[model samples]
Target: MAEHPAYPVGLRLTGRRVVVLGGGQVAQRRLPALVAAGADVVLVSPEATPSVEAMADAGEITWARRPYQDGDLADAWYALIATSDPDANARASAEAERHRVWCVRSDDADAATAWTPATGHSEGVTVAVLTTSARGRDPRHTAAIRDAVVEGLRDGTLVAPHHRTRTPGVALVGGGPGDPDLITVRGRRLLAEADVVIADRLGPRDLLAELPPHVEVIDAAKIPYGRYMAQEAINNALIEHAKQGKSVVRLKGGDPFVFGRGMEEVQALAEAGIPCTVVPGISSSISVPGAAGIPVTHRGVAHEFTVVSGHVAPDDERSLVDWPSLARLTGTLVILMGVDKIGRIAETLIAHGRSPDTPVALVQEGTTAAQRRVDATLATVAETVRAEDVKPPAVIVVGAVVTVGPATAG
Candidate 1:
């Protein structure tokens, strides 16, 4: 008999009983989706993988720790017959069939009442692909098609112009630490939907090239100490574009609130009576140090880590940081935008009681192709920066934690 085309319909499994006959790789892969759908999942397996066991331990699923017994699918709305033993799987599938419950069999798809589709999601849409030919099943082809559609939707390449919804507002999106892939999913989606993008000198610059031609890209040269009142100009631009009924994105490097003046932009938008959304990005404060093989806080090394802006010298009246207090603590110090003033900052820390021999690691262009790490001590960091010709957009880590992981050649 020829295989009939499988009817595709989403099952609303919320609060429904889902019986999984095996807790091996197949069950481990499928359980999360079941749990996410709010299904009451029960597993009947003599043994399970560590990951599946962890789910049972975390109260996400009920584990029977036994073989599939008769009537296991009596109350189940749906069942997965995936036990290693073909006999056990067939028995469970027959029980499901008798109870009128839909079942999927990992070992025998044709013997099951239901088939799992290759699924991917993007921006509120779920893409599920299935190939139903009995002798020509190609899961890889289905998955590839799913991935292509999802990727296109995510990057705005396959946008439906007729059904596009335009949201007019300013969004402060943190693009993450210099890497496009490091950006948050929401941030990337907002950028795809943006009509006007005002981008900073830092953040994922490569993403700009992927935008549709209709998008107006403006270079926000808000480089540190470059121009006075550049932030005011950016704020005004955001207000102006949003008032014109355009979706605007202020793409900044690292987290917008982490010394990126994100709150100031929010306040400015509020004063202008315009709506704004702030999407947090991965901060370089800790990520950069970790990327350079330095943990901000290590076991028995440093207990606390403090992130501070080194844009201003310690002696500068505009500075609000307490060098003496920071020096007294034996925690890690992560400084951003302080490469130019590192010499003065190091001296201040030493004068305030921090050891001159404290290890320091400067990660430049972190999380990007141009990334490089430079090592030094508080006493020689100034000279190291000078000798190495390290530029801006670097994260400076200070503490014994810098020496925790395998040392990277500076």
Candidate 2:
């Protein structure tokens, strides 16, 4: 990841009055980084934390202990805000834009023209994790990710391909876990184009808000974890709507192929002679483990991965799987809908000679904005989940590699 020579590097904020218009932990966290980079950081807020005041008292940073002024951005080459107030952050972003200054709006990364990477330092070895949403992209998510990365400095791990696509038509978009914004660009684009939006109830309401107002939002919205319409009814509706020349968006919570019946719908669409596309959204199967800070694949931990569905009734022959082989495979195993059948599934594996204490990560709402992860050994996962009341739409990852989640997840 080299930069072009013409590209600007970090600004020379050293000794320059770089204004920070907030006083919370974000400011506290950024202050040390700014100082380490030699920026003369001036915190301007009505209040601050104990650490902030401590820094200001020891000549570590300067403070403007009053309300923000009209021209707070004067002589500021760089600025940042963490006011926890949307309107204030908006004003700060607008002012920075007007001043033609390099700014990092912590609250709204999308509004800023530039950003800071998630950097980690260990005994003079510093590593920074950056993303495509680095500059003027989804900054809020990036910033939060950056912060999490920094907090996990001691646990610096290499990155892997999450596998994203930006094609047109419906991707059976897997909105990761509960976070609507986690949906891929391709998935979002299809939603915008959908004339008829047929979604499962598990799909978040805020995510659906991205659709055009006139789009017909049909809630064939199945909640497998909860209860709703029959599967045949939902599949038929997809064909019926697509046949009408309407761009049908069959929205699934996580990647459609992962227990979401995305393949069935695509097959049905093909049979109906409707042009269909499958956008591979982030499946909660793997992503849930990730959301819980567990990696489905890790060096020496797990080498291969298999995604399976336990939601399908065992009466269906296709639902029957080679549990014995799976138990023998030296790889990570992610099971969707295996939560309800945790006992039977685990028993099958154990009977097939798999270890009883294999690490299992149970993630609810996998990658969504609001996620919950429960780490337990294979021997106790079923009981742990029941005790936690962990619901469906959750992912159960099994193997040695999954142990990394709780330690790695923020």
Highest-TM-score candidate = 1
Give the Cα error of residue 388 in candidate 1, in Å: 3.0
Candidate 1 lDDT at 58 equals: 99
Decoy 2 TM-score against native: 0.54
Clashing pairs in 1: none
Q: Residue-pair clashes per candidate, as listed?
A: 0, 11
* Candidate 1 to truth, TM: 0.91
Model 1 lDDT vs. the true structure? 0.91
- Candidate 1 residue runs with Cα over 4 Å from true position: 160-164, 222-228, 271-273, 405-410
CA lDDT, every prediction? 0.91, 0.71
Task: Give TM-scores for every candidate, taking all chains together and pairing residue i with residue i.
Answer: 0.91, 0.54
Tens-place lDDT digits, model 2, residues 178-261: 677667655665566567877877765676765556788877744233344467677677777766656677777777776677
Quote the RMSD, in angstroms, for model 2: 16.6
Alpha-carbon deviation at 93 in model 1, angstroms: 1.0
